[model samples]
Target chain A: MPAPTRVFLSGCSMMILLIGSLAACVQTAPPELLEAVESLDRDLVAIQGAEFAPTEYARFVQDWAALKGRMLAEEDVIRWPWEPNPLAAHLQKVQEEGEQAMAVATQRKEEDRRDAEARLTLLDRRLRIFNSRVDEMESRVVLGQRPIETELLVRQAHSFLDQGLFARSLQATEQASTLIVAQTALLTTELKRYADERLVGTWRQMARRTIAWSRTNQATAILVNKADRRLTIYRNGRPVVSYQVRLGYNGIMEKRYQGDGATPEGQYRVVKKRDRGQTQFYRALLLDYPNAEDRRRFHKARRAGAIPAGAFIGGQIEIHGEDGLPMSQTLGCLMLDNRQMDKLFEKVEVGAPVTIIGALKVSNPVALALADLEQFEEG
Target chain B: MKQPFICYLMVSALALAGGCAQPPTDKLTTAEKAINEARAAGAPTYLAEDFAKLEGMLTTAKREIAEQDAKFAMLRDYDKAEQLLAAVETDAARVNTDATKKKEEAKAVALQAQQAAQEAVKATQELVKKAPVGKDQKPLQAIKADAQGLIASLSEVQTALDAGDYRVAQIKAKAIQEKSLAVQAEIQRAMTKVGAAKAQKDKQVKKHSSR
Candidate 1:
């Protein structure tokens, strides 16, 4: 062969040799990559083991390094010039592969994160509920009332609330209220029979009868703020003592019959205070709520089976002192703070005559005065 | 005439070499390689990326199932997720099922590339613990630290699975899932510990025990 032909032949042979060597070099990749991949798989599977041992992380890193090495080898093959752009088309392909892996990993990480977040949210909500329960307990103590066994129920409700369980909370609250009411009603009936029979029936009739007597005898006016749960004694525009009290769960105008949950919206008197310990929840404060008018209605409802047979309504109701419990949770009677009730107990005698107002519609003094001034100016 | 003929012969040889010579085969796709890498890395999103389409369908099915409270509907969703999982497993089964066929060897090896993809899907189903906060920003060091810990655990699992130790893989997977809760607990404990150091200005929120 001529010198020029020899050079040309050498160049072609070299190219072929380089290509073969590069192919051979790349051939090591699959097994190496497989090893790296297997290492990763081992680490992942280990995570699912009992007691996720954090020590496994170290092994993962070592395996990851091996994977990176294999990736580099493939890259080297692609970059080799004699290998005819071994890494060219393959680089894009491998990179895409990397991208795919990354995508899958990212998705799994996100799902894990969201699950964690949900758990955190649930925990926070439960904590809030716990705090609320503690608050309720404190309030009950402050009011000097008995503690009921609703802690477990409340805790269950809290659990539900933590899981965004609003309906469950409502149901639990309703249930708690129902049990309390049933118990209170039973005690009230027992106590009322122990007191005056003539005073039994509906609050409206009781209010009318009591107010008629108080009006005739001339009694002191009572101011009740159902919203703030306060009852104030007033004589000739002078504020006497004001006591915080708990009213019906529904603190509005008193309903005449059952399920009204309202404090009576009319005037009534404290006819008597029974010195008997009545219900399991509290002591008795028998007030003359449904007097003669109450009896008339009670008989009517009794005929109708609306008030249940021989249900006495008035004897167990009165303006009384705290029942030595935490909260002022009561069923229709006026519950006063211990100190306030003690003071009242001394100052007033039985039959001193008290009037009950349904609502306290006091105008904001600042706003009312301003309006009055404006009116005066206009006038 | 002889030089011309030799030139023609060289050209024909070059043509024959170019046409007959296989450039490359048994080369994996980028997606395939990525699936494998993600499988090893234990990166859930990477595992799930290729399954985005299927996952999207699954999510819709899940939402529909969630909307109805009927037991039948809930079972349907469970079945759907199971069906999809079975399909993925079937695709992966190809790698091991036809091991004896010589003609199917290359194809089997090629299908083996899908094991990584299947792994990605499995990893995608894993429950999440923590996520990065802020828009288009990387997670904080604490968050990343937790993730790194989880990643490490998952990687070990991958290794075990590759070694064909199915039991070890299962154990590892379970461990990672359990420890994942620690990250959030850590964050909360840390916050509380720090909060305790601050001025007790927060109104002694009345803690009520009675409901």
Candidate 2:
């Protein structure tokens, strides 16, 4: 009886020991933890966790390593299945921490991206408006390298954005935008004279008179609108058509003297018609630019110290052809492409009236651009 | 007396341990100074990618130091942080060298553009001199004004170059060159018109005499 009892007890003790050893050797993990960690990994990369939430991400990384180390160490231990597996609970806690970090990272990234994108959009619009005004005044030479610098900054901002450095990109764009705003302010102020309603009314009235002259005499007339960048022909009070024309480099300003780069605002007559060989502008209708009114204004400006004492009353203003030049800016002249000039050259004879004005429409493209610039400045 | 002796030994041991646990502040300062010098040398503009990587190294080093700082003093370690800072310093020196070289190249380019712009302005001025007299005078004067504008922009380029803003100088000089070329084209067109008009005037004079 003693030998049999001893053998049974020994076999049962061995069985229990082997079962406990098997339980301890088995590496058990919460199944959902794998999927949860993987999901957090994806979001972490997507949100640039290392960049946006570096400290938290580093902590998560350290916890992950510790959990793996604990799991590996537990593989050699012998314990009953009833014992609580700390690895699973540790993994669950680390996963929760990691998930929390990823959530914060994603939110921060979205907020920074939104802020940077809005700034970029505003800077882009400001640049476009600045460029337009530059073209309008042909002020490229005046602005020097500012436009180029602003453009480069925008390109760099886009590069930083591509690298997910939103704050740095925003800083670069903000610097570029400051220059654009200053330049635009200067240009808008320079061109503000053209927006004066009283001056515009005078120009419009002068244009109306020229059209009335055409309708009364059943003859052709020419109207140059600086703000519209347009030259329209009226045959017997009806607008025959319009063509895109380039004015002076500083054409928005009323002409004062020679080399002023202003297209004079006045009524005139096409005193002579010079066909291609007769004129240097490909073909030309020479105009009386400094009529009595022009001389009177020039004298007044000189007396007021606005014009230099040595300045001459500029002459030879004409309606002319572009002759295939790429520039749209003219020297106080109404310019047309050679093909358009051919049509215009045959439409009117010498002495057909021509009137030049600042603006005929209140909401021309240039005026609208100035208004947009004001809104930008107000912001 | 024995307890006081034991306390002195512990104090010395703890002091040694604390010294070992301290962050490599001197290395961090050296690395930060190097980064600043690199930035001042225009590394951010010319060696942008390499500079960015260097900056990333600095951030990592700072984080590593911060990690150690958050640990118990007796357990803190700065060996990894010290390595990161050393790397940053080395890379920052390389970036500074590359950026200076790039800036010199840009300066040379800007000078070349300035020469081209100057030549174009001269050529355009010559054409303006030969432009037809009566009708082209006003327009030719305007062209001269444009040439003057080009000259003024060349001055701007010089100012930027003098300020060590080679990129800005290059941009200004290039713009001047482009505008000068356009003005030259315009003057050539005017010269052709002048020639044509002279030929026409000759033909007219001959016809009237023949009739």
Candidate 3:
């Protein structure tokens, strides 16, 4: 009975030992390892959801897969009770790396958002400047006669800004700016040409002749430069006094025909002098315009079809006093203030030589002066 | 007799361990559903950090359950996993609510910004209309075109709002406001300059005519 009992007991002991050993070797991952893997998985999902930098996300995925593979391989190794799981360390490393990757991705997303915001702000500012400059040009009436290319460029720039293409918007705005500056230059050139090409030479000859006539007669001679809106009184061949004058609405150009609002250019004599009550103006020194040279030019212009038929060479041109009205308001006359007209009338005779010319010089000042004169004339 | 005694002890231990240890299936499913609900509520866009934390917790809970499944039958214990999953469900619900509240707030702000931008565009357009047509016309027309572009960008703001990216929509609208304000300021300056120039010319004309 003792021998059989001992054999049964030995077999039961061995079976219990085997069962306990199998339980101990189950190789269940620790809670921490599972937690780390789950954390890593969450990070990967976030990375994907965020649409992080492709290179960084790809690297993170590869490293995560490698660590996961290593953890699964570690499961195949036999584990004994009281021994630490080998995969636990690897999983912890993967989790740590995943966390780092996720952090970087989050940071990158924040940075990208900030960068996009900054770009939008810059683009907006640039578009504002572009818009303002265009407005300025339009306000100045600089754009009415030109092509619409600048506006198109501005629109292109604005579209670029709207699309978040900051560089393209900037480029378009710059192009518009360039076009505007070019147009300004072209306008300035045209203004200078009007004064230089047609007015300067005639003025020099008229001024010299008037000075000579004054010196020879010891009398006052009047010389007017319509481009400068200046009237000079020469006494005994030297300048005596000068006064600012105004002319017709189209005063910058030479008067060519009747009803043209331009002050005429030529040598002439004062046909009559009248006091304030006798003339519409405060005082008047009427000139014999359409004198020999003017009549000749008018006849030639008519013959060449430069002037319309039935348009006569105008007469009754005068140096008049406006009292207080602007001299520019006259039809086609040289005008001065009443005080200046009174002073001249006191020193001049009815037949005194009077010369009216286009300009005094060929410089930009003459052009600018004429343009300013034209403004006053229009007003 | 001893072998039977040991077998009885093992069976009793197994029964005791199994008695209180049910799988956390219901809690896990509940937590998963909560997480899905939060995602559908736009938690990721409006509450990124909070949503990520919730996701990590859910993942940890699922991993704990998986760990329990990997264990030997006698050693399996899902009590901790079940508790964590229950906590995750609560956190997910809170996250969803908070995200919805924040999203609504952001939407209000975005709407205000969009209205402000539209107003700016209108103001700039008015300025363009009042702008004089002269040498400055080219630049003014260009500016008007830019203002038109800003108005067009409002559509993009709408797109962002529709997509539930309220923050982005607000930022874009703010940009438009700033630009339109600048355009208005520019128009004011131009008008002032034109006025000053006209005044000076009139003064000169009066002085010359009076003299």
Docking class of 2: incorrect
Q: How do all models score by TM-score?
A: 0.35, 0.51, 0.42
The complex in candidate 1 yields a DockQ of: 0.02
At residue A145, candidate 1 shows an lDDT of 17
What fraction of native interface contacts is shared by candidate 1?
0.00
True interface contacts retained by model 3: 0.00
Best by DockQ: 2
lDDT, candidate 2, residue A223?
Answer: 91
Among all windows of ten consecutive residues in candidate 3 chain A, which has the lowest summed lDDT?
A: A134-143
lDDT of 1 by residue, A116-166 (tens): 445445434443443343232222221111112232234334444444334
| Interface RMSD values, listed in order for every candidate | 23.8, 9.3, 10.9
Segments in model 1 whose C-alpha atoms lie over 4 Å from true places: A1-94, A100-218, A236-238, A248-265, A275-285, A291-315, A324-329, A349-358, A362-379, B1-211
Task: Quickly count the clashes in candidate 3.
Answer: 19
Number of the top lDDT candidate: 2
The DockQ-based CAPRI class assigned to model 3 is incorrect
Q: Mind giving the per-residue lDDT tens digits that candidate 3 earns over B121-142? A: 8988888887642222223434
Error of 1 at A62 (Å): 26
Best candidate per TM-score, number? 2
Q: For each of the candidates, what fraction of the native contacts does it recover?
A: 0.00, 0.00, 0.00
* Cα-based lDDT at residue B3, candidate 3: 100
